[model samples]
Target: MTYTALNKQVQSPLTEQDKRIIATIIQRHADEIKTLWIDCGITVWVQLQDGGRLAFDRNWFAQRVAEEKTSLEAQENLHRQNQRLEAELKQACTEYGLQHGEIDYLMFSTKVYRGRDLVGFVGFHRFSQMWTYSRRATEPDRYARSASDALAKLGVRQLTMV
Candidate 1:
């Protein structure tokens, strides 16, 4: 039967035989059935010829839509946060007279200095997701404040000085 005829029949009150015929046709053209239920003011359930049933609740549909919207919003928020972090990093690099490439290349061997005195070695630690500093060959507590200040100026929040 043509889709127009099937649509007209579905719009009208259906008898048991009519329902069976519609179910059979739907099973044969499952991909073409974009909308399963019409405005009959009643929940509709149809068993296909293969014994699989097509059914859904309006409440379930609404819940799924809400979930998708929440997921999209969370993704957008994460993207914005990443962008803000990147901008902050760029600004910090410029203010500290440091280049991202230099930091990356000399992360492990580079020494951070305050004026003419060497405070510590600056490097990025992958496991801790932080920039770390190892104090020079001296007391562990020495240059702690200077190391903290230097890392802060570079926008490195996750910093550890030892």
Candidate 2:
């Protein structure tokens, strides 16, 4: 709706594309988006074509991010557990010589969401490398050689998620 003053100062002028994205975010996530933006200390504000200004807080955005991180961890844990159980079941089927169906390796996309709104998604394959590099960066001793080797082999592509 209506905002009198931007909670934080925005240096860049909002573009039409930004407006569209914000409108989509607001429409899709509603209160969660507002809360997350406010929590994260990020600004989403625009001077409209009609000359009215809209503003939102960054801290609110962070809340959504935090929630999403929690959700992702939970989902990943559940998925790993399910995979383990499936493997056990498959082993049993093999022992009995039963016709076991194909075991599909479920690859999920790591979605970047602002609350319920999906801003982007990184596929499982992409995320795996991301995890590897990030792990190497943080824990240098464990992956130093492998990380450097990967970087040598893949160059910048090793760091890119897209």
Candidate 3:
């Protein structure tokens, strides 16, 4: 595997110490995390002003669907369905990647301001099974509260309405 892009714009600047701080702060709110994110299938992906982005882990997702699907399929059709599901997952991830940073495609897009400066953006979307992709740009604020709370934890102090 190639290990290029050290200090390049494409490189992730997160350090081991930074990761530990984030992990520790998050563990303190396990219940809220479960309710706001895990139980609801919510995602609050961030893209920084410097062009760095943190997106959903597609490889992990594909592996997760593979494990969950075996239990949902009959013995004879399991392999076939698994193959189809894997392909569908890949396609779905590709489409999400394409639309992720675009404001027009977002159900809710918020500017993350740390103090007075524009530091990054937190884009929220409801993810689901392979077939159910986002269609409505104007989804209800039923999810916005949870997204806002999550962004607050990420150090976003304010949001400029779009």
**Among these predicted structures, which one has the highest TM-score?**
1
Q: Can you write out model 2's per-residue Cα lDDT over 63-123, one digit (the tens) per residue?
A: 6546655766777886885465445434433332222233334642222222344322222
Per-candidate Cα RMSD to the true structure, in Å, reads: 14.4, 18.1, 23.1
Please report how far candidate 2 places residue 162 from its true position, in Å. 51
Q: For residue 47, what is the lDDT in candidate 3?
A: 34
- The TM-score measured for candidate 1 stands at 0.36
Where model 3 places Cα greater than 4 Å from the true spot, the runs are: 1-107, 114-116, 128-145, 157-162
Ranking by TM-score: 1, 2, 3
Candidate 1, residue 16: Cα displacement in angstroms equals 39
Candidate 3 structure lDDT: 0.36
Writing each residue's lDDT as its tens digit, candidate 3 over 113-156 gives 43354434444443522122222334332232343343344443
Off by over 4 Å in 2: 1-55, 99-162
Per-residue accuracy of model 1 over 11-122 as CA lDDT, tens digit each:
5454554443343444445332333443354444444445555654655544554665576677677566545534544554454544432233322325544446554555
Judge candidate 1 against the unseen true structure and give its global Cα lDDT, from 0 to 1. Answer: 0.46
Point out the worst 10-residue segment of candidate 1 by lDDT: 139-148
